[model samples]
Target: MKRLCKKRELISMDLTPLIDVVFLLLIFFIVASEFKKNETILNLSLPNSASKENIVEKKAIVIELSEKKLAYKTSEIDFVQLEQKLSLLQKDSQLTVKIDKEVKYKRVVKLLDILNKLQLSNLLLITKSQ
Candidate 1:
């Protein structure tokens, strides 16, 4: 008499589906994220405004000003350098100024003066809603 032999099949899991799911999730998150280049660099307390007008901003240049620091976009610079940068922009370019509430009036005036000399008339001063 002869004894019969048994054979077992090897089991394996396909990781391709798992990898695809992870890749899709990564792509979804990347597309949904908002990247702010300059706004988060400085802490500012904007003054309150009583006016109810809501300004809808299109593509515009951003200038952040604090008591001790002035930033063009995200890079910290002095008034002279800021002026030079502003001069290169078009006269009608929309400029958005975000100044700290604690900043002195003199500094605000100085910035306004630079904008005036450059003849950049399209200006928007950002403030908090009361």
Candidate 2:
């Protein structure tokens, strides 16, 4: 018989696994990106300060003073329970105060005095810039 020559062939890589991994990563990032959008809005206005550091407000004792009466959070509170209320609030976490513009300055000062007596050092007064 005459001599016969066989041709050699190179193998190619399978792309099925690589394609599957790419699809999984795309789905994961899409889900994560959607969750970054915030849902609720805080209607209150905040003034700018020279210090650019961020101050996080975890919780606060809102004192809304209208022309009618003084209210803490939602309910009206007398000076007697003011200390107890603040103490109770302090037991769980830190707090700040959000006072309205129309509120009397004297009332705010009195509350500050009480807070000092309770030994609560950190106090933030919320106000709008004119």
Candidate 3:
């Protein structure tokens, strides 16, 4: 009598290798991205939260304001000078304003108004957490 042959499984796929490749790519992006380029001059005491996403990949020219003075990047610049530089730079009007916690609110508002007057469309305000 002839013995019956066992049927083999037709469909089979390995996910382990694919998962490993994805994991490696994730790690590569994390490592390749730079978190900070220069010593962030903005004394923005950023408000803390339960969770905060790391600001990476998106590099923006930093502008800082303090009760003591106003500045672009690290260099101290007057409002007129700032405007001139802004025009010269001719970069995106969108800018980030890093303000000290102790600074007056009116000052911040005034800054926003000036940015608007300059037609700067985007403004990011910085604040500190209690």
Candidate 4:
């Protein structure tokens, strides 16, 4: 007698579409994420230095000084306001100072004076890498 039924083949699912969808979602998330841009409010021509050290502190307070204005953590502030805000910080608190390359010497001196008076010496001066 002849066999009534033929052998059946196994069915398999294609994974190419699943992988493509996952990669597409990954690319979408990568493109959608926003990176933090430090001191984006001011157009600063930062002075360049040859040193390659990146000593950014996570908890440091940022002070940005441009030719026409000064900003503390992105908010425009005057010298008195700066002094007041800085005075509230601990002596050991880290401070990141970003001064424009075109800023006047007197302004830098003035900022140094305030820092000196406060005795907040944990300072990091941010400069562009050469």
Scored by TM-score, the top model is: 1
Off by over 4 Å in 3: 1-37, 42-44, 48-59, 89-93, 127-130
TM agreement with the true structure for every prediction:
0.76, 0.47, 0.53, 0.71
Candidate ranking under TM-score, highest first, comes to: 1, 4, 3, 2
Q: Which of the numbered candidates is closest to the native, going by highest lDDT?
A: 4
**Candidate 1 TM-score versus the reference:** 0.76
Taking all chains together, the TM-score of candidate 4 against the true structure is: 0.71
Off by over 4 Å in 4: 1-38
Misplaced by over 4 Å in model 1 are 1-19, 22-40
For the record, the alpha-carbon RMSD of candidate 3 to the native fold, in angstroms, is 9.1
What tens-digit string does per-residue lDDT give for candidate 3 at 1-130?
9999999979989899999999999999999998875645545555444544435225455678777677787788877787777665443545666777667888777776666666776556554433
Candidate 3 residue-pair clash tally:
1
lDDT of 1 by residue, 1-130 (tens): 8988877878899999999999999999999998765453469999999888657575778898999999987788999999999999998899989999999999999999999999999998889998
> What lDDT score belongs to each candidate, Candidate 1 first?
0.89, 0.61, 0.68, 0.91
For candidate 1, the lDDT comes to 0.89
Model 2 per-residue lDDT tens digits across residues 46-78: 444455444746455565444335456666767
Query: Model 2 RMSD to the real structure?
Result: 7.6
Candidate 4: Cα lDDT at 107: 97
